[model samples]
Each structure stands twice: as structure tokens, then as C-alpha cells.
Target: MNLTKAIAGRRSTRDYTTEAVDEKLIFRLIDAAVQAPSAMNQQPWTFTVIRDQALLERISQEAKACMLATTPVGAHSSHFQTLLSDEDFQLFYHAPVLILISGNEPNQWIVEDCALAAENLMLAAYAEGLGTCWIGFAQGYLNTPQGKHALGLPAEWTPVAPIIVGHPKSAPAPIAHKAPSIHWIG
Candidate 1:
């Protein structure tokens, strides 16, 4: 697929089928993710793939509880509150795979680097006819002691991106892209 096409076409997929993503395909996506550029060539990302259905459910419940408790602060809290409050809303959207892109070591650019890699992964999934969504709601829980313990992650690692991948139940309907705002500088 053309780079521009992939950039414009890839959408955050929320609706996924029950079918699991093949292990090989998941690795391929990660391979694409590592190709992303990093600040000072510091490839500070590590990956944790979670396929356990029961575990995902537990995380979803815990994350929703955590988000509900903290929703009183953020500007967008009310919006998320509604979704988080839904008893039926699964944080991973029933996706068969949840891949956590984490920091290998702390650095100012670790978050940015992981995010770049996340974009690469998502785009690659789109190219491969898979769907993905970066589940920000899961981040807080995933970083907590319990969450890390659940994933068997070391204390030094921090999960920056919790992306869920699967076969989308339906192709995403086309949506409008906002026009870029330009400010000229010489």
C-alpha cells in the first residue's frame, strides 16, 4: 500500500471479531513497529502480547474502576465517564490481541518513541487487513503495580501503548479528516 494511503486510511478500530490474530502476523506488525524513527536512535520500546481472554476481562474491569475514580479531574472525563460506566463496554473492544508497547528504560523521549512505534504498528495492521486501537483507558491500570504484576513486567519498564488488534467485524466506514492548520514561518 502507498504510504500516503496507509496514513490517511488507517483508522482506530473499535469493533473486532472474536477470531484471534495469528502469532506470525502479530510478530510482523511488531517488526514494522520497530522500523519507526526514534530520538537519537534510542529504540527504547519493548512489547508484551496478551492473549488471555479472562485476563483481558479482568483488566477491563479494573481499568474501568480506576478511570471512574479519577474521572472527576480531566476535562474529557465526563465523556469517558459515560463509556466507562457502561457495564457492557469492553475496554479492549473484544479484540483477540492486546499488545503493550513499553519503555525499556526511562527517558524524556520514551513516550514519544513508543507512540511513533505504535503508529507504525497500527498502520501495518491496516495494511495487513487487521484492525487496531490504542486503548488509552487501559494505560493507567497497566502501569499500576497490580497491572504490571499481571503482565509480569519488571519494575523498570513502563507500558506506553496498550494497542488491541484483531480482524475488524466490518471495514471502518470512511470518515472526514480535518484540514491542517498552517502557520508560516521562515
Candidate 2:
């Protein structure tokens, strides 16, 4: 797939099929992710691939509970509250694979670097005819002590991106994007 097409056509896949993604494809996605540029070549990302269905379900439930228990204070809290209150919501969208991108160190650019890697992974998945969704809802729970222990993450590593990858049951309609706001300068 052309880079432009992959970039523009990649959608956040919520409904995934039961078919498991091949391990080779997952590795390819990781290869693309790590190719992303980092600040000072720090490359501070770590990838945690979760394929256990039971564990995925547990994390989904725990993450929802965690989000709901927190005091609603932000502008996005109401939206999240709706999701949390919904009994059928699954943070990973039942995807067969969950790729958790963590930052090895706490630094100002860690999140940004990991996010760049995430975008690369998502686009690569799309190019390979797989679907992906970046599940931000899992971040809070995945960062907790229990969550870290459950995933066997190092104490210093912080989960920055929780992405679900799988075969899409159906393709979502193209989402219209807003026009970019540009300020021209000399």
C-alpha cells in the first residue's frame, strides 16, 4: 500500500474477528514501529505483546472500573463515564492481540516517541490488511502496580500505548477530517 493511502485510510477498528493475527505480521508491525524517529535517538520504547484472551478480558474489566472510580474532572470525563457505565464495553474491542508500548524511562519526550512508534505500527497494520485501534482507556490501569505486575513490566517502564490488532469483522466508514488550521509565516 502506498504510504499516503495507508496514512489516510487507516481507521480505528473496534469490531474484530476471532481469527488470530500471525506472529510474523506482529513482528513486522514492531519493526515498522521502531523505525520511527526518536528524540536524540533515545529509542526508549518497549513492546509488550499480549495474546492471552483471559488476561485481556480481565484487563478490560479492571480498566473500566478504574476509569469509573476516578473523580470526573476533565472535559472528556463525561464521554468516558458513558463508556464506563456501558456494561458491554471492552477496551481492547476483543481484538486477538494487544500491543502495549512502554517507555523505558520517565522523560519529557518518552510519550511523544512512543506515540510516533504507535502511529507507525497502526499504519503498518493497515498496510498489511490488518486492523488496529489505540486503546487509551487501558493506559491508566496498565500503569498501576498490579497492572504492571500482571504484564510483568519493569518498575520504571510506563505504558504509553495500548493498541489492539486483529482482522476486522467489517470495515468502518471513512471518518471525515477537519481542515487543518495553518498560520502562514515568512
Candidate 3:
């Protein structure tokens, strides 16, 4: 797919088939992610690919529990609280692969850098005829001590993005997007 098409057609896939994504494609996605621009070229992102079904299930359950135990502070929090409470909810949506992006340093731009990489990964996956979803709900739990140990990530490495990639069960309808507000000053 062309860059324009990939950017315009990429959607957050919530449901996926059980087919496993190719390891070569996964590496290509990571290569695309690293191509993203970073502040001062720090490029401090680390990609952890997870394919264990048991671990995915455990992380989903634990993440939901952790989110539920926290006090809701706003409408966004309240919405997540409701979603996490649903017994059928799985954070990774049963996708066969989960890519966790982490930052090695506690730098101010680490999160931003990781986010850029994640966008690249998603767009690349879409271009490759794959589905991808950014699983933000897993962030809190993945950053916790227990979660870190479960994923075998170093304590200094902060989890930035949890993305699931796989073949879509079915094509999702195009979602209408609002026009962006623009301001220009000369």
C-alpha cells in the first residue's frame, strides 16, 4: 500500500483471526518503527514481541483488575472502568502477537519517541495487510513491578506502547473523522 493509503486506511483492529503473524513481517514492522524520528536521535525504544497465549490472557486479566481497583478521576477513567469490568473484555483482543515498546532512559521525550515508533509500526502493519491496535489499557499494569517481572523487562525500562497485531477477522467499516482545526500565523 502507498503511504497515503496506509495513513488514511489504518484503523484500530479490535477483533482478529487466530492465524499467527509471520516472524519476518514482525521484524519488518519493528524496522519500520525504528525508522521513526526521535529527539536528538536518541532512539531509545526497545521492542518486545510476545506470542505466548497464556501470558497474554494473564496480562489481560491482571490489567483489568488493576484498572478496576484504581479510583476513577474523570469521564475517560469512568469509561475504561466500565470496559475493564466486562468479563468478555480482553485487552489484546486475542491477537496472536503483542509488541511492547519500552524506553531505556527516563528522558522527557521517551514517551513521545516511543509513540512515534508505535505509529510507524501500525502504519507498516496496515501496509502489510495486517491489523493492529494500540492497547493503552495495558500501560499501567505493564509498568508495575509485577507486570515488569512477568514480561521480564528491566526496572529502568518503562513500557510506552502495547500493540497487538494480527490478521483481521473481518474488515471494519470506515469510521468518519472530524476535520482538523487549523490555525496559521505569518
- Best candidate per lDDT, number? 3
Note the residue pairs that clash in candidate 2. none
lDDT of 1 by residue, 1-46 (tens): 9989998888889998899899999999999999999999989999
Of the pair 2 and 3, which is ahead by lDDT? 3
TM-score of 2: 0.95
> Per-residue lDDT of 20-116 in model 2, one digit per residue for the tens?
9999999999999999999999999999999999999898898899889974679988888998889888888889999999999988899999999
Winner on TM-score (2 vs 3): 3
RMSD of 1: 1.2
For model 1 the TM-score comes to 0.95
Shift in Å, residue 181, candidate 1: 1.2
Q: After aligning candidate 2 to the native by TM-score, how far in Å is the CA of 29 from where it should be?
A: 0.5
Give the winner by lDDT: 1 or 3.
Answer: 3
Q: Residue 9, candidate 3: how far off, in angstroms? A: 0.2
TM-score of each: 0.95, 0.95, 0.96
Best by TM-score: 3
Model 3 per-residue lDDT tens digits across residues 49-135: 999999999999999998888746886886877789998899999999999999988889999999999999999999999999999
Give the clash count for model 3.
0
RMSD of each: 1.2, 1.3, 1.2
